[model samples]
Target: MSPCTLLLIACLGVACPTLAGCDISMERQGKYKTEAPAPLFADGTSAQTPPDDTVAQGALAEEQAAQTPPPATPALLARGRERHDIFCKPCHGVSGEGDGMIVSRGFPRPPSYQDPHVRQATAAHLFDVITHGSGVMFPYAERIPAQDRWAIVAYIRALETTHDLDISGRPSPRTAGGRGS
Candidate 1:
């Protein structure tokens, strides 16, 4: 072959192997496939269940707090009122008749705490609703802490118990007034 042809063959011989080695695909990376045997662990499984009783970081306290509600003390009710005013009043209204300012401005009215269904709901149910939300409401799990959610539930329960009755134990005008008449 001519010198030019020999030089081209030499260059190609050197380049082809180098170019082939340039594969940076993810398939070549060190990783365990799902359910594939992983020699790294003693059990030889790629997916390992957490060791028994392993609580996720920061989850132990959260789980405990979420499971137990604090007593309905005045301080808790006050905090709940404050939090409710900030987070719920806009949509649920000051009295929670679902006449909140946002509803007046055209947002859908949330259910009234005075509703029979709501009054019959357990405190846990209300807490779940606040945390997970229902209907058009968005979840407040990230925004409201668990304690605050429990406090809100307490305040809602208070609202349910007292919304209809005045200090003298008579139905308030809000309920017994011209509402139905």
Candidate 2:
């Protein structure tokens, strides 16, 4: 192309408003404005709301907050037993005596659920504690499934039914030779 013509084209290109810039300015002004109003979220939930029936409800103020009881099916108990044996029994003992192998070593002892305080705790409390854990115990919020946790709690309650121990009831291990060592 001619030098003059090329120079004129380059100048026009530099001076002309870009198609993208024009669209952006148009969007900022009329119905197709770029600064469209933000969508209002119901209950401040960012995602689209699920249908009414599917949502889980929180406990009411007047009602005692308790773990929603699982279906008292044999399957649930069995599952709970299985989970307890696998996860809890290792540290809590088969009888929930809190004298598992780990405790026999150097690990700190866990409390026996047979204690009056443990026995009196509501199901909701157990669920909260198991889900969230306390002290040396780590939260199993992600590790244990919600329903399975309830089952484990049920098994723990069962453990209390058979044992009669207390906060200071842990037996001191006697040395093989009957010495204080």
Candidate 3:
């Protein structure tokens, strides 16, 4: 090995022993004693506890809930209809009957909204499935915005409400899946 390489290795070996003893000290109580350092992540941010805001804690959730528009807004439904027709209809069908042109061309049969399995799903479940996607369905997270995903959920609810038929004397709930009557 070169002299420089050997010197570097020797310097590092000597430094490691001394560095092992040095600890980070926080300046408090007028002391310079060794102390455990605050946890530092690889990204260089300290993993310290965040301060709690009383007003923002409970109030934020309530405020967000209040500020959030209803799931079944007409505007959202319209937007969802447009997005659904553009992106989902090729496979899910124009009316969400799950028999789109793609399916007719052997892309596999899509699930009909009126089907018993779909009828049992809550709106949250449908939204999650739509956002994350299910078997053979790619996730729409990248293509669909967060609010628009909810809008699509609203549109799907509209489909279920309008197209759902009574079967075995059970009518599907009118609201989006999961919301209590």
Q: Find the 10 residues in a row with the least total lDDT in model 3.
A: 30-39
Error of 3 at 138 (Å): 0.7
Report how far off residue 34 is in candidate 3 (Å). 41
Per-model clash counts, in order, read 0, 4, 2
Ranking by TM-score: 1, 2, 3
Residue-level lDDT tens digits of model 1 in 47-94: 999989888897888878999999999999999999999999999989
TM-score of 1: 0.64
For residue 181, give model 2's deviation from the true position in Å. Answer: 26
| Superposition TM-score, candidate 3 onto the true structure | 0.53
Candidate 1 lDDT for residue 69: 99
Judge candidate 2 at residue 34 and give its lDDT.
Answer: 38
Q: List model 3 lDDT by residue over 1-181, tens digit each.
A: 9999999999999999899877666643443233434334343334434557536445555445433546576787999899888888899898888888998788888788767778788776876787678999988866776666667777877887766334443455663363222
Global local distance difference test of model 2: 0.70
The Cα local distance difference test for each model comes to 0.88, 0.70, 0.71
Cα miss at 54, model 3 (Å)? 24
Question: Which candidate number maximizes TM-score?
Answer: 1
Better of 2 and 3 by lDDT: 3
